[model samples]
Target: MKKTAFIFPGQGSQYIGMGKDFYDTYACSKEMIDLAGKVSGIDMYHLLFEENQELDITKYTQIAMLADELAVLKAVEEKGFSSTVNAGLSLGEYAALVASGVMTPEDAFKIVVKRGAYMQEAVPTGGAMTAVMGLDNETIEKICQETEGIVSVANYNCPGQTVITGEEGAVSAAADALKAAGAKRCVPLKVSGPFHSDMLKEAGLKLEKELEQVEIHDIQTPYITNVTADYVTNKNEIRGLLKDQISSSVRWQQTIERMIDDGVEVFIEIGPKKSLCGFMKKINKEVSAYHVDKIEDLDVLVKELSGQE
Candidate 1:
């Protein structure tokens, strides 16, 4: 039997007009965006369609990314396609929750709004994140330790690609050290703050309080967690894990490995970009992967899911 996993993309996947085609074609997509706008007090369509690339701040980026991913998911659902397992990276995790029926779309929108605001305010001092390639995790960890002043590994993206985040100076020094240690590249990411690090602890704390007011239910489908790199089904544990995910390193590599170990053979990335598909390929080339970010892609995916391709 073939098993499939649905994964969602995080912040960096957002583009100027992501999901616009779906938004224009599907009434549900427009209604979802409208509801999100009402709850978030953000003109989501404008932010996603009109904002300048440089103006897409982290605060706005989170909401837009969530909305776009959800829009794509809705389209997929309307076509009667489903998956056996699901997971997401960073902000994409919230989308996963929505997909799994663990969180309502409205609640997901509200939480992401608060999450983005808190994350922005939490690191008011402004920080930086960098992706180091061609380096093993141990080498990256050593470089993080060698650099002074609060630098730490934020995301273990893959075997040879890890992202470090922290105070700007510390991150810069760490990047230089990683290069000296023979890293292929240490490129600074265009993000507003140091995410998934201790720097976001304050944001995590604030989010915990907000989380209490939101409703959480058991996942309808098996879902992987970034904090634990394992499957979580209990509602309480899932809620707690989501809170901790704010400031914890995203164990993406571990999560993917665990999914594969559990028998996921086909991974479909449902979102605005193919970022997760790319990552999944790197994680396991034997497992087939596909992405549905355009109308034609969705049509093709529907066919593939129906065994018509």
Candidate 2:
């Protein structure tokens, strides 16, 4: 039997007017948008459909991205397509929970609102992140350990791409060391803070308290967690994993590999950009990857995945 996976992208994939097509074309999408507004208390239409700096900010980015992703996913599911497995990167995990039936979309929206605010408010001074290209994770990890200050790997994105985060000085020093160690490029990320680093542990603790207020139900489909890069079998582990995910390295590379190893042949990236699709090509060439950010993209997906269903 063939299996399909719904992979969602995180923060950097956001853009203005992301789910406009879906919102206009599908009642499900419109309901999602309205529900997000009711739960998040943000002007959903203005925040996502119009240009604004806050859309890129952490506090607003998480919910906006989630709303957009959920709208897209709902539109896809309405077309009679579904997935065997699911996974998301960083902030995208909340959407995964919603897709898997582990949490209601309304509850997820509420949690994300607080999650985003907590992360934004917890940004440490002088914190930074940098992408290390063309370097192995082992080498980058070793260098980050050797570098002074609170530097550490933030994301294991792909085979040759890893993101390191920490205090600005530490990240800069680590980038220099990584470059000298033969990294092809050490690009500084335009981010608000050292997300996924130990510096954000306080934020994780705060998120844990928020998680306690929500109810988690049994999952309908297995989803890979970024923190463990493994399948979440028991719903009991979801909350802790989400909490730890705040200050933990997003094991995206490992998560995708685990899904592929488990026989996921079709990966549909349901977000604004082809970020996860791009990563899929780098991670593995054998599996088919598609993106459904716009309504027109669904035409191609229908043609390609018609046989799979």
Candidate 3:
């Protein structure tokens, strides 16, 4: 079998009825959802499947997205699929950890419950995120540095796409500067907080305490870390990396490149959105990228991975 990497997306990917197909089609999917609710003390089914106001909220969105991703993951594994490596963007990291055997389902659920709540609670008002298109990371970094306040690049998503985050005024100022410096367009994102910015450092500290409670197991399958954009072979680094991830720029582009260098020929994003797959195309078009959001997508992915006769 060719080398495969299982990637999961983070927040902003969740929507109503995301994993309903998997929930209905696979018993393991339902069991994972049930376990998520039991562990998190939230109604996972209603939060995800039903039309509700809580799904978008960060605290709830984290667990909801993780549940959906894991539901689909369960079904994929049952289909006799496994990965050589794993990675996830931001909140999706927990799902990756579970898939890599670094964390059990129960432990991951427990951490996410706290992770989501901490992020939600730490979302300071007057903070914002903006997507800077057609601008190089260095230019964006320079503009953010020149601009006042705590503004910085939040996500290095692709070659020309990077997200900036900071105090509302600072982010706006930086966005304007970026556009003036030849950026295609600086679009203000509908985000609740300055995620991946220094403003959330407190949340990271809180998560560090929470991490101390969970057991970081040996890597059955090595997974990459968002903080450093490299494979995490040392189990000891898990806690610090996960804690710092909340306030660090997500080096998504670098992470994907690292995987490709390490022989990840196929990347299967198992989650609600094809966001990561979209990024993969921008990062490198030669390799194959697939997303198993629905049962039908899984069929296509299975065929692609198993190869054609």
Candidate 4:
């Protein structure tokens, strides 16, 4: 029996026409998309299937990304293949929560609508994020801590790639420091805001209010949280971690490492792109990684998983 992990990707992975294949193939996919539209009060079909600049905006990006991922996830489950554990990055966490049965997709959909809006509203002006490659987490953290402003590590993406976020000035200063500390390159990211940084604390607080309105059920499958990079078995920890996730570093590398350690032999990424699969390669090369973004990808996945059985 091979233990598998169903991983989901976050914001940057979304694109127009992302889940059209699944939507056309599975009734459950269409139902979930419609449900997301109803809960978020946004026309998910147009938002996802048509060309629009709104898909890139934070307020709309969050829910749209999750809806696509969930559509694919439901389709995968329909094939009778499941995961031993699950996890997702940032916005993708909501999809993982739905997969884990901690909350209904309807509840997550509604909350994600607010979550996106609140995060967009809280995006501080003049904030910036940069990817510092070829630097260890300890050195990056040291530079951020020693720097003069709100700068800090945002994502520990993989072994050598770390993202730092904060005030534009502080981030720039940290980039200089990281470069001087033998970093390979410090490239600025063109994100709408400095996500997963302390600057978003107010946004996290606002999201906490929205989270209170949702009902959290018992966990059916365990999942690792980006906030702690560890498995969360107890459903009680879900709410607080979600709130904190807005203002905390995304420990993605650690989360994947933990899953690999816990016997996740295969990682099936159910989403629009192979972003998580790319990360998996940098994190660990031994585990088999697959992604389902198109109808053709589903065929390969079914054959592989069914053969495993």
The RMSD of every model to the true structure, in order and in angstroms, is 1.5, 1.3, 1.1, 1.3
lDDT per residue for candidate 2 within 139-226, as digits (tens), equals 9999999998999999999888999999999999999998999999999999999999999999989999989999999989988899
lDDT tens digits by residue: candidate 3, 48-97: 88999998889999998889999999999998899999999999899999
Residue 6 in model 4: lDDT: 91
Model 4's TM-score against the true structure = 0.98
Computed on alpha carbons, the lDDT of every model, listed in order, comes to: 0.86, 0.92, 0.92, 0.91
TM-score against native, each model: 0.95, 0.98, 0.98, 0.98
Q: CA shift at 103, candidate 2, in angstroms?
A: 0.8
Encode model 1's per-residue lDDT on 1-309: one tens digit a residue. Answer: 478888988888888988889899988787777778888998887887775763267788888888888888888888877888888999999988988889999999999999998998887475899999999999898879878898998998877889999999999999999998999999999888899888899898889899999989877998988999888868888767878998998999898899899888988888887988777767889988989888888889868767786
Location of the lowest summed lDDT over 10 successive residues in candidate 2: 300-309
For residue 134, give model 4's deviation from the true position in Å: 1.0
- Candidate 4 regions with alpha-carbon error over 4 angstroms: none
Query: Between the candidate structures 2 and 4, which one is better when assessed by lDDT?
Result: 2
